[model samples]
Target: MNRKVGLFFGTFNPIHTGHLIIANHMAEFSDLDEVWLVVTPHNPHKKKSSLLDNNHRLEMVYKACENYHKLKPSNIEFGLSQPNYTVNTLAHLQEKFPTNDFCLIMGEDNLKSFHKWKNHEVILENHEIYVYPRISSGEVKSELTDNPKITKINAPIVEISSTFIRNAIKEGKNIRPLLDREVWKFIDLMNFYKK
Candidate 1:
């Protein structure tokens, strides 16, 4: 039988604790066998300068997810075109791994801002989407699509964020709890996010 995987795509600038929580939760609660952390090369809406190099981000993701059996990091977007879109990546992944069933796992925060993604409907029409809650926000229409493949999961609402971690690091504050030990060590070794 083919494996069912969830593609959790993001810049993952530093791959913090919240991202790990969501990926693990999706694997455990959703109809997915595992979750692949598809680290994006770039996000159009965010400043590229704020991002760690794609390879570094991938390394951070790998370190953070290494102990989690169901979580793995992929650099699929690294060689792709600039300003990569979810729809295109999904299509490429489907074509590349036709036998695997891939799902889109995202936070409710993205759903709220989904309209901004390119070819959002194509993504919704093709794959299952598992959305974790954002803070106390109630049900809101997914800006991506009205397709029925979207499912809301009652996972932990971890308040940690990469932006906060970067800011803390820049200010010389402790970020041990904000990220995994291996990831923290990697960041320190490379001096990542040092403004």
Candidate 2:
């Protein structure tokens, strides 16, 4: 069997401590050989405004993951067309890296709405999903909870969010503890998220 790779998809408007903590936990504690932080160029459900440029967000990710051996930064979805779906990205990744077993890393909240995703069943059939705990309101379906392909990791629940980080920065709050040192430096240098 090939090495297992966990794909962590996010806008990563700015990679913060919470994102790193969960990613590092999965890498160090789980069977995944490495975790790729896939920087999304665009998310359909989210508003376009208030988001940093694609490259800016990606740069922060790169800086954040620079020292992480098992964690990587990926701009894979950047090349794909806009409003791309998870299934399509998975298919593309599998095609490009046939040897690496790519599993998805998601939050507990996403699992609740997994059925609504386009071709959700196909994704489940083809790849494993690793879910981390999150503060959400819904209950997960029994069929999904019973699925052998889905694993709920006992990872730390990161209460912090990128939005909080961005807002804090804009308000001239020191959010150093919530972000990687390099990422903070990059954001500060670029004057990002500051209105």
Candidate 3:
């Protein structure tokens, strides 16, 4: 029998509570054996200047996921080419771990721009996509809404964003509530995001 694993891809700049909540929820309710947090070294859609070092980000994810037996922190994208594309990552993972059934875990907001991604159709055809709710302009719906491969989960809407946390930290504001306790401690100890 194939082990079902959900790929929760992100920069995880500092791995916050919101990310943990979503991954944990997906693992428990989505019939997934485990949720792997794939940390992207550089996302094609995001600015590189705003991101922390890949190793640092990976460490933060490790700290946040330490207690979660089902959540695994992955640095698989680190060896991949620059401007990491989701399709390529998924493809590589499938090749490397043939026995594992990989599923894509993302937020509803990503569905809005899903088509623009490289080889999105291939991704949809090969893997199941689990999308969680996000605070957006309107009720999040996608062209893939009718597709059985795409599963929309009513996960909690976490309004907190990595960008917001970074800004708050730079300004010396309290962002403890927005982060995992260990992650917050790591950030504070390393003086991350300080201007």
In order, the Cα lDDT scores of the candidates are 0.84, 0.92, 0.88
* Arranged by TM-score, best first: 2, 3, 1
Q: What TM-score would every model get versus the actual structure?
A: 0.89, 0.96, 0.93
Estimate the Cα RMSD of every predicted model relative to the unseen true structure.
Answer: 2.5, 1.4, 2.0
Candidate 3 — which residues are off by over 4 angstroms?
43-47, 138-143
Backbone clash pairs for candidate 2 read: none
Write the residue-wise lDDT of candidate 2 on 115-181 in tens digits: 9999999999999999999988988987999999999999998899889988998899988999899
Model 2 TM-score relative to the real fold: 0.96
In TM-score terms, candidate 3 sits at 0.93
After superposition, the stretches of candidate 1 with alpha carbons farther than 4 Å from their true spots are 43-47, 136-139, 142-147
Q: Model 2 residue 176 lDDT?
A: 93
**Model 3 over residues 40-110: C-alpha lDDT tens digits?**
78655666687889899999999999999999999999999876678888889999999999999988888
State the weakest 10-residue window (summed lDDT) of model 2.
42-51
Error of 1 at 111 (Å): 1.4
| Candidate 1 minimal-lDDT segment of 10 residues | 136-145
How high is the lDDT of residue 28 in model 3?
90
By TM-score, how accurate is candidate 1?
0.89
